[model samples]
Target: MTVLTDKPESPFYEQLSGIVDEQILHLQDARGIFLLDKAHERYMRYYLRNVAEKPWNNHLLLSALVYVDKNADVRTIDELLQQVNVRLVDLFKIFHLSNMAEFNVETHMYQYLKGSYYQEHSDSMRSKLLALYRSLTYSTRKWVTSKLNSDQQSYFEQYLLPMPSYDSRDFSFTKSAKDLAKDTRKNETDVIVPLLPQIRAEGHFRWNQINRLRQTFLKACEQAKTTSMDLPLEFHYDEPERVGERFYFRLWDKSSFVLNHHDQFSASSLTSAYKRTGAYSEGNNRYFVEFVKAERLDDDEKAEGLWFTEIFEKGLIGRWNEFVDVTDDLIQQKRELLYSWGYGKNDFTENSFPFFSKHKGILTPSTFVSRNKHLAEGILFDVEPLYAAVTFGLLAVDIFTTTGARINELLQISNTRECIRKVKVEDKLKFSFYAIPKGRDEVEPFYISEQTMKLIQLVAKFLKEHYGTDKIPSVIYRGNRSHLFPEPKPYFFQYHESSFNHFAVGACLRFLLHGLNFESQEGKPVVIKTHLLRHAFATEAVQRQNLPIDIVAKILHQRDIEVTGYYSEPTPSQVAQSVSDLHDVISDYVDLDEAVLRSGEELVNELEEYKQKVGVFNNVLGGACTTNFVCPTKMQCLGCQAKVPQPEKKHELEEVIELSKDMEKRFTEMNLPVEVKKAKAMRKHARNELKEIELIEKYREEQKYEPHIQFKK
Candidate 1:
């Protein structure tokens, strides 16, 4: 056995006692190659130890491991390399099954490789596994080349196994625009729009109700004592109509017992007394219900209980039926009240009710009830964390829908009050919050509506109250790359659970949507992933709000306008409308005959031919272009007569005129006569287009009154 005691031995080291060399374990060249940081060092050490267990004594396998270990990036080590470790173990098992002494490139390995690829049912998994295999082969070649002379390296490279190429046509992994649009419509109509009002109303109602009950519970705790002479303890409800008239109980050393409305001993409701009294035990720790009994008040009360059996035997079931009806009516009234506030039938079921048997059966009393002294002092202990979580999720939905932030960006929102700030734009105050956008190290402002900012502030106020702090406490994020020396950031999307990550945020959103009982147009249950909200925001901006693509791109924090275009492509209906509008714009500019407008197909064909002659027909700033080929005028559409100025794009043309004037001034100062002349010409063309549009608008206004005045094109 090669005993190496320089460092602490890994748990997996025993499995590879003799097969691996001590030098390979102490290899310093691979330190920077694979992340040997505190977060990932253990995984690299374990991987090396585990790979050494392969029965075959092959230098090629050792070389491949070292090569990949040194060359892999942090992401590959964190995510994909784990899969590679498992696959390598499986490959080693294949070598044993084939009875091979070492890894042979020309023998049974190729057949096994081909069969493994074909065995995978998922196209994506197959692609991933193939990439890993190719990586191993490429790394092995590189490692061999570094260890050998040029002539020897070239000869060794030819014998290496070739990797199969991935097919480009298989795009099942990608989502199309149509798929995104469908998701947007479903989420907008079924969940996001409907759930907003419910979250606000229910959150407020539940918060108030819980606080009121909490105060009553605290008062009852102080009033009822084991040393007190009061035989029967009492805890009154704030609103008797919601729960019941009152709860009468007697707390003993080991357990507690309940008394019914008539002050008669009730065994069935004893379960509630046990739970409530357990919450109020000394030191606030739960009391075990070992023994419980309702003591007799006097001889007369005991005699009344004994007579109930005779009354039941004497055909007096009518009285029992009356009591059942009254109980049912109270429950029905409570259900109706909840329904009026948009709560579904499922929410009031036995599974959800805190006092019910089913709820108590699965959940411990401590799970829902808080025993924190601060919460008790603030009269907020009765509020379950679930209600607060729902409120937090509501804030998340509002931020996502309004600001179009990625889920990670939303999770990383700073809890500082200064996170939300106001800036004056064109003399109007606009609100935006600073957050770390995806793929960026520094924070940027994400603009939100004033309404959203108010809701966020309200939630922050409640968070401070719950935490008993002037400022929300900062906690380190514990997901993904956070393990690598993470600093604490006061992320806003957290609750009692300090380590809120992407999955927890996702679960909160899904829980709210599921409770809302939303369904899609096809009657299937609505499923809203957080990323879908980003798609909805983009689609709404383009198709409904009609915001410019570049403006939407900037708001979405995308550097490339073309990438934003994928998110905001026009639907078929919008494209048809745009084409219809384009036809009218073309008629106003060109002297076309009636034959061109007689048929839809002929008009479309003519438009295509006209676009070919013009240069480019796509919609651009200021108006739609008439040309099909690249513009020889270098997209100075304002100066080109081939461009049609749109009334909707008049604002864009005005901006162009301003830009032209600024350019002319700069060019003149620099003594660039030709550049200044071009700028002047561009400004003149824009002014002329604006004048023509104004005259057309004036004529249209006059024609509306005259009715018979025909303006020539």
Candidate 2:
């Protein structure tokens, strides 16, 4: 057993009085020192043998084991120790260890601890020979669980996978050194510095200045990807450097350091928002009106407005009759009154801050989902206006929003996931929410799946990695002072999982119409928007060969058939593809050998017999045919050749077989491109040949093959 010499020292008399043999065993086993010491001793013995025999695996081990106490060689003097003096002198190259024994011990200890991994072996394997060594180390008897099983051994091995490899470079400090140079010149890194200062400059990133700089840097990133970046990169009131190499790295590194330093400033700003600290200590003890804040609303603004009633009344509640039946006029009237103070959408007095759609920023998968949830909860009143608002959102923002779901859908999904079931309605000040009851036996499940959940989770993971956990906002939303997810995020934004439907629709409309409400560089209305997706989805579904509208509706969750009908039905091309698939299946069935067909019949019967026990759907016949061989001919018994005996009513086996054969032939003919073309050509040829006697005789004979009739020529 591994001996732990660090055990508490006690008087001999006290130790003898308190100890029992079983208790001592338990201590050795629980403390785990028994196994470790045992393993170390065994390994040390093996190492010693290797040093004596191999002599070359490690020259240092050879010197230490063979010559430590011997006088054969002067070089082997390094292997010897004067109990303390010589060991100290020989171990460390740092600060002549000969001067201090303590220094040598520290150097040796440090080396022992700095393995590539902190804990490479498990407690069990550390002392495999515990039984043999326990007597030598301590007066105890102990046992442990059996050695780790295959699964457990694999688990431990996987756990150590993330630790530093032996070859891992110490780049953390090297990263910081270059990062410091970046901080000195934050802004103006893209463009060359002019000889004269046109305007007095401050270090703050104003919106206009920030916009220009963002564009400049985006160009630089693009240029870096394609061409050489020899230009000096600069930042706020800082010097530029040759940023061609490691363009993005030093920027992120320096930003991290800057954010770390500014954490106090951030906390203070949020705290001030909450407490109304500085400018609100007037005689009335009231926070007065100040500049309108887009990031935070004042006390008057915190009141969640009854947005539903206002927009619903203003021609917004036109789409879904489902909501109309669920909602009422009394609730909506109150919502309209709430909007009288001015909705956030039309108001631009806040210095042209984000005043469109559900919230600010480019249309993205994350933001779109959030917006969708907002709309569903009646945070925004109308789907129609919501559509228009999205036009503003996407068109105004620079980022592409088409990939995510409509913003309205995203919001509803988010609310479903986050809505705490029954008990309180304290959070939203003015916005109205419903209270849906659940049974005691039921547990509320999330509506936003992993696909949608990824939107916000990606944000948090990114923040933790680049900004550090300390810099993240305490809340998911930053509304009442403790804001979360601030701007200028340190990391490259992680990709979102949801579709940016609303954002795309909003942007496209603006691009096509050229800025309905907000000012835009492109004067015409934007062409794309979330609403167009409804059309796009319908058109694409209907035109795709073999894809049915009903199936597409199920995918899109269409409750109203009319909404689906607005999309055109399957085109001629789509029908052709469906016919093509059917032909392929029939071919496979026909090509099977006669014996294989018999085997298939037996298998089908067996499948049916097992269905009841297996809970298989008996209604579905196995694709294979079984023992029964229905005759393929379709003629009546007197005229049919395949039936053993014909039925009087003429539903004989021969008749059925013939009908089956004819049906297969007809379907097969439709599948053949040449046959289909020939059929069309024959129809046209007969129209031109109608005046001829031969053609007329042939046409009549074709229809005269009825069993009861004979044609007279």
Candidate 3:
């Protein structure tokens, strides 16, 4: 119903005209909003893929395109926009988008049908809709700005440069305790010791806030019944101290009065009684606090308090978990409650009526709070938070435990062919998770255990069922403004009740740890996070298991070995134990006759050269030893082409041959055909190499001048 008619004389108007010329603003659209054509849509997609990574830039563009007017004067446009209470991208998502299908349009009016059976969309659409909306807006703004002349650009900057901003309070949203540990160069022990308790307290605060709201709602319902009336649309209160007593009051500047009409004989009488409490005035200003229904709540008004309506006429008012009425109707009612929190509403029909929503004019004590938790407490956690915690909790646990992916990399998973692959592992069928890791340029698959694969499938199945789609929906993260492209497709981790993002991912892990009361190996409370799993993986691979650094780097998808070096470092105790063990191996195995040793220094130099050639360690022969060539296989050094024939080291070679034969026998007994084949080949190669070493030792023994190897040494 709101429209800007007739162009005005102003520099801002001229810019608007230029934007219209570029087809960025099509005021002729049904809602007097901008709509994208096929060509423009493609261009926007390209921009989103290549340039605009975050929604902030897109939001600014859309705010200007959707809310700005050509008729407004350049000098007053900023003030006018502020007065209009322009809706943020979050608000637009809640009310404007009914489902994914409607999201592409700039802004479309949605209606609720009477006696309708249409299933409402999932809450996850919030982020999806915003992403697409911002992409369009960002592309449009870029196009408009590019076409601007220097004078027009200067005018645009002066008028629109100061953007509307609000704090999101997302400081702890992205980084997990593990991520912080990596940045601060602290161990998990140090990080978890402090972070775990704080997050646990945060969780408790969140739950308690919800409980208070639910209790208050129930009490208000009881009061309504005592009065023989329907649910109250709004709650008025005097002060925090008297909130328990339920004495309703409204306060004016420097004065306050309680609503004393509850004892009135009839509903009409009570209405008439309170109607006289009109707007109070001081110094040419008058204002009144008005109550409205939740269904009609809009972004324009600031939220005052909650409204408990009869939308749930099923007479269901208790703990959310116990309620069996999961029908579409109940879900819609829940959406209405969220909308009243100044986010967005699911239904915006004319007769919907507000139960919980914002209000105009002066606010009472119950109306104001500093954080979203104050308004969100019971309303949000009641139906969806638990489900989210369970779903994403299991997801985070499995992904980290198995593949050890970074949190952002996990977010990149989608039920697409590119993200998943089936491969054989240890001779058994297993899944290979392929992804382009954070800060990396290439994609590779990391083989995960069967258990991890099953968990991933479970999550994928749930998403498919919940969205009712065969196609996989991609997970996307807005990055720095410079790189705005949507990640290569198929996002697997999505929230069922709200938009999925890194913040949600971290919260899920924290909530999971809180719920499980988990502790670390050091007996400290555990704070599970994405990067911690990465570090754990590296430590196990390079230090504990003695895998190669380059291989560890590849598994972690690191661009260089230096980044992985931090994680792969051995502890002081680990280093000391390794050195002690190596000393024992050398003293037990190295034996040389003084006559053949000729120069002791020459023998030491030869050993040093061999160690340098093999880079100091080779465990495939059962223990660390000097080598002059690379091992040909990933397994033990049984099949190494560069192994030296040392008669004194004959026992180690014999042990390797026996180990290979034993491994092959086990594979055959286990009926692992693929592994049996590999093991059989390794055993055959080890036997041949052992025979050659024995022949060389026999020849040395036959020649009395040549010192023979003594295996007993």
Q: Is candidate 1 or 2 superior in TM-score?
A: 1
- The weakest ten consecutive residues by lDDT in model 2 span 577-586
- The candidate scoring highest on TM-score is 1
In the range 274-326, model 1's lDDT, one tens digit per residue, is: 55455334455432111011223333343121111221222111212223333
After superposition, candidate 1 runs with Cα above 4 Å error: 1-120, 124-164, 170-280, 285-382, 423-430, 483-485, 520-523, 560-563, 569-713
Question: How far off is residue 282 in model 2, in Å?
Answer: 30
Lowest summed lDDT across 10 adjacent residues in model 3 is found at 576-585
By lDDT, the best candidate is 1
Q: Please report, in order, the local distance difference test score of every candidate based on alpha carbons.
A: 0.45, 0.25, 0.39
TM-score of 2: 0.21
Question: Residues 1-713, candidate 2, lDDT per residue (tens digit)?
Answer: 33434442222212322322212222222334322121112223443443222212122222222221121222112212121122222233434333222342223423422322225422222121121122211211111113334553343232111111221122232234334433222111111011001000110111112223233344434443455432222222111111111111111111222232344345654454345455222221211000011111223334222122333333222222123333556435433432332222222222111122223233211222222222222222212223223222321221111111232332222222123111111211011111111111112222111111222333334334433443333223211110111222222121122222332334323322321222112221112333333343343334522234554443344545565555433322221110000000001111123224345566456445443331111111111111011212211112111111101212232344455456556757678756545444433322222212222233223322221211111
Ranking by TM-score: 1, 3, 2
RMSD (Å) per prediction: 21.9, 34.1, 27.3
Q: TM-scores for all candidates?
A: 0.46, 0.21, 0.34
> In model 2, where do residues sit more than 4 Å from their true spots?
1-406, 412-460, 463-526, 568-671, 674-713
